[model samples]
Target: MSSSAPNAVLSVSGIGKTYAQPVLSNIDLTLLRGEVLALTGENGAGKSTLSKIIGGLVTPTTGQMLFNGRAYTPGSRTQAEELGIRMVMQELNLLPTLSVAENLFLDNLPSHGGWISRKQLRSAAIEAMAQVGLDAIDPDTLVGELGIGHQQMVEIARNLIGDCHVLILDEPTAMLTAREVEMLFDQISRLQARGVAIIYISHRLEELARVAQRIAVLRDGNLVCVEPMANYNSEQLVNLMVGRELGEHMDMGVRTIGAPALTVKGLSRADKVLDVSFEVRAGEIFGISGLIGAGRTELLRLIYGADIADSGTVALGSPAKVADIRSPVDAVRHGIALITEDRKGEGLLLTQSISANIALGNMPAISSAGLVNGRDESALAQRQIDAMRIRSSSPDQLVCELSGGNQQKVVIGRWLERDCAVLLFDEPTRGIDVGAKFDIYALLGELTRQGKALVVVSSDLRELMLICDRIGVLSAGRLIETFERDSWTQDELLAAAFAGYQKRDALLHEAAPRNTL
Candidate 1:
């Protein structure tokens, strides 16, 4: 009765997709029950498109798919879910306005006599949250109140609630903390024990070796390789993912450092950024590293005047201290630009044309007598498209149609067109591919070479170590320490990042009296 390959849980053959061009072509892959397949590729290499086809989000141009040795073509997400197939997409689908308990069991909330059972919901939520190390969070708390990393965990927990045989996790740990990642790994192990087939998509090479039994490398819409994880070392995996050898890090040659380009002092925000202070030198890259909810993003928001700081002083340029940045306009006028962390919300206008979006932050430059020059805007967009190497059919294309990486490039391209003296990048490479990431790195180096100061915030510790001349650690809203490139080690950085939370726990124990300290 089975039409699929023997013992295969899911099978895809001759799958192809075309957009402005052929994004994916003649693809074939199979998933086996109780096995983990690590799916990896550069951005826009058709990994997400292929995942979308399997998840019933996007119809493939041409392909045949089978699940459990039977013809399986899901018409919609609901159909796939009904067939015991689920996907945790990179862009979360949860309603942020709802409570954790509500979002987790939204599809099948407990009800009796036409009344919702809050008591049962709390119990179920606690159990599910505990699985992902979110036990301490209140179930009734709104998901909007959670940070990005916490929200990611909530998304994963929601997926695990139902009967699932095949699950596709796209960039599952991209925003997770170290501890949260460990909890996720544990959950994956349990799922494997229960005979679940998992297709794990991630950019972190080390994580694949830990969770995936087999690795499948996709490049340029083709199945480049599928081999045992042990068969491919980290370097070899990178080679396959990008179809070339990539160095561990790019070396930015030595340069003369100028006076401080931007200086921040006494930066404080209620319960988010506390007494943060730092100075970024001209032609140098400074990095900030910390755990999720450790105030890294909040600190950048404060400096850029996106969020009001309770107490702070921001001075731009060497020896010429200027007015405080009370608004984003003030920050911009002072030659400060912030590439925000949320590309979907803060960084882009997805519904607008790519040319229009790029003209957003550069209106003053692109406009003539208060009216934007259409020809100039198109030319500007075209210049950036070439410089950023964005893959797009035309400047008239909507931003939403492009991949995440291309959209990010548009954001950076906007600032590059400006004459900003200091650039603040928040999680700049969050979901960028290795190739695109290196390009951004080279761009950063080029920016610094032009004497522009750069402040970069990233969750990847290795990335911070490699790119920044100096790095600062933010732990629980406090700037714990800063270290030169030669001084910072992974262990030391992690220790500094986790120090605040450890001290807070110790203080609570001492105050509790039962656990006297």
Candidate 2:
């Protein structure tokens, strides 16, 4: 559709953004009232850049925007919000120290005579929280106490509070549960009924097909296609996004399976993880699949010594001798590495250069007598840059400058420099695109070929089935069942994931007293 179309609620002409180099170029797009538009592309394809431009997070270098056929130039996010435009970015923006209610209505708190009205705030917060399936959480509770998934919901609820004519959601479901995703979709439907335009960005092809009315695929900072969602299938959409045909199956390189490399026995950490026991053999990939709040991450944290296990033993090697791992340093000494889900927060030092970040754990190799060797650090970072095919200008470039996929590569490169016996990956391909996901899968294959034991935790069941030799299902803080690669089906795995919760709910119902008239 053209920018002058009557139904267009917002339109951009010749939109582009640049930082050190051109990222977005000559983008012309229109958002119609009461319609969902899907924006998709590979990592570093400038989708986020364009959205930021529209949402006033970033100013366009060369473009003009029109809202309802009038000139619209927002200098800041607050200006955009005042103009009824909102964006929910992938990286959450919330005050962890403040209560959920405060964070939700911080800009426009309900007050009387310059004093905050707790009653009014709580009532309004409850109404908003219920729409996003967060009614169980107390509004007075600090946002820091909630999990990442709930924080994402609160961010969404905050944007949904005031008037919003155009809403942009960037990977909104990346940290959300299946039920929460449905609730968000229901809210989206309600907003659509109110004539609110939406721009939905995600890597999941199925969700795009379900929620988007029109699909726009960007590649290499260019707009390639804009068509109705029904015009293309998932495969076609992926092909358009990546500019190549990708197969559904993967060819994992052959490797010899050896004795157990890492074993956990009776691992329990409060109610988050309960008596979890598993073994990952050398050259084997053990996958963990579970719904949100099922304690998948907690189990990984305990194994990596990031969290203490109340009662458990972590044994290493074939003879299986228990290792005394109390902290991350000890875990590293014992040859265990964890690639955290919060890569930005835990994995990399964004303000530092690529060489500096890679030199973190490999200080011994890059330093001499309490001094870092510049040449050695550059060489180390360059090796991984070439090996992982990380697209960066130079080793001196800051980690914050790279895209999501490239940043993840930097994290993996740091661990690859070490001879770790076991590797734990939490949502390795969480926010990456389809092509980048395959890159990670291939890396896992290479790691296994090198006799490294790998444990992967993913929210996507299909991902586990694709790369895992054996998959373990976590349900309600317990390991429900483990399924072999070929022996498991989607339906069976999902059923097993919910089994523990079902049993717990049944017992709770049976224990409750019933009243009769």
Residue-pair clashes, model 2: 0
lDDT string for model 1 (1-517, tens) is 1335566899888889988788889888888898899999987777788888899989888989988877888999888988888899977778889999999999889988889999999999999999898999999999988877888899999989879999999989888878788889999999999999999998888899899999998887888887889898888888888888988868876766789998988899998888988999999999999998999988988888888989878888779595578889988888899998777768899999989999998998789889999999999999988887887889999998887678889888889868899999998887788877888888888899999999999999988888899999999899999999898899999999999889878988788867445
Off by over 4 Å in 1: 1-5, 320-322, 511-517
Model 1: lDDT to the true structure: 0.88
Where is the poorest 10-residue window by lDDT in model 2? 508-517
Question: What TM-score does candidate 1 reach?
Answer: 0.95
Which residue pairs does candidate 2 place in steric collision? none
Global lDDT of each candidate: 0.88, 0.90
TM-scores for all candidates: the values are 0.95, 0.96
